[model samples]
Target: MLIGDVARRSGVSARMLRHYDALGLVRPTGRSHAGYREYSSKDIQRIFHIESLRSLGLSLREVRRALEDPSFTPAELVADLIRQTRERIAAETELLTRLRRIDAVEPSGWEDVFQIVALLQALGSKSAGKRQSAALSSVDDVPLPVEALVEAALSESDPNVAGALRWALAQSGEESLALLAEGLGSPAAEVRARAVQSIAEMPNDGATTLLREALTTPDLVVRRHAALALGVRGVADAVPTLIDMVVEGTNDVDAADALSALATRPASAKRIATKLADRLAEDGVEPPARRRLTQALADIPGPTASKALTDLSHDEDREVALTATYILGLRAAR
Candidate 1:
């Protein structure tokens, strides 16, 4: 076959075949009497081999080494190719995500696109201050897609940046609730906790509903955060988990404060008091936990709480008795 015929059949252009010949990658095996290049069957086979290697992202130099070097080992080269491919794929995926986020914003012009891109880059910047500034400024001009805010909120490790991201997500109202709800089911414990915390900042009813659903999650951190948010919203359903938080010593102070907030309601105050008293009466209740439970009851009004405190004032544990007595005195002073 001549060069043109080989180019036509093998899909390698004639120009590339000549370039390959110049590089000694593939040379025609013979010449015609007219001095034109001619390819033998084996030469065509070598061209096919070069094309095959190139398909696997091999550079021309690597392809030359692979085809001609007797000492070359394929294992290391193949592993390197795999690593490079992975990196390319990761870069492409990040680009696709950013493009989708930009598209979701419905940018009005090139200027809007540029602004959104700048904000996104800042959100991922290495400096915590930059990330926080980006989060705070997200809603200033171009409205960033709620998905971006939720993703940032979930992955942010810096406390200030995380708080800013959560605040930004809250400003998106109920739009971010769905993504944050999915975050609640993440296999990562930290992600679930972040999800709950972000949801806590959202003031809409949809966020409240999700927070209520999170009350029974198996993640202790998620449940505690959800319960505290619900307590802030005056949701009576948070009372049980808030009590559990007091017993477990996980954010027990905030849990007690939430319980106090809930107890301000006449309808739920007695119920909250009864639940705390019951926890204090449990057989294996530790002294520290029991003390926390007693302190929690101090803020709760209604006769049930008073009667529980009066009974606790004479308890066998000295600390518990003194705490109950001090609370009773405070109540008397009131």
Candidate 2:
């Protein structure tokens, strides 16, 4: 086969085939009597091999080494190609996401497009200051995409930046609640925690509903965080989880505060006191945990809480007795 025939059949262009020959990658193994470069069957097969390697992201130099160097091992080269291809894919995927966000901004013209682009870049910047600035101003001028704010809030590692992003999401809209709720289902525990925290900051009824649902999720961290928030919202469903937080000693102070907040109504105060006394009565309730529970029960105003505390005032644990005695005295003074 001649160069043109090889180019036509193998899909390699004639110019490329000549370039390959010049590089000595694949020279025609036979020549016609008229002095033309004529390709033998083996030469055409080599051209196919070159194209095949190129498709796998091999540079021409690498392809030359792969085809001619007997000492070359393919394992390392193949692994390198895989790494490079993955990097290229990640870059392209990031670019595509940026483009989609920009389009979603519904830019009126070049200026709006530039503004969205700048904000996106800042949100993704390496500096925490830049990310926080972007988050703070995210609601400026053009209403920023809520999805962008949600993404930043879920992935942010810096506490200040995370707070700003959560604030941005809160200001963004009700749509943000759905996105943050989806983040709760993420496989990563940190993302789920962030999701619940962000949701906790949203004051809408939808956020409260989501928190009630989150109380049943398997992630204990998420459940605890959601429980704390729901307690502040006066959702009675958070009572069990809040009580658990007290016993577990994780954010027990905040948990106690939430419990106290929920105890505002006389009926709720009695019910909450009953639950605390029950947890305190459990067989395995240790002294320290029992102390925390007794302390948490002290803030309730009704007869049930006072009765529970009066009983605790004579408890076996000296510290529990001291705490109960001190709290009971305060209640008397009031």
Clash totals for all candidate models: 0, 0
**lDDT tens readout by residue for model 1, 258-291:** 9989988677888999999999999999999999
The runs of at least 3 residues in candidate 2 whose Cα sits more than 4 Å from the true structure, single-residue gaps closed, are: 29-36, 313-334
Q: Model 2 over residues 216-265: C-alpha lDDT tens digits?
A: 99999999989999999999999999999999899999999999999999
RMSD of 1: 1.8
- Candidate 1 error regions (>4 Å): none
The TM-score values for the models, in the order shown, are 0.93, 0.86
Error of 2 at 196 (Å): 1.7
Could you give me the TM-score of model 2 versus the true structure?
0.86
The CA lDDT of each predicted structure is 0.92, 0.91
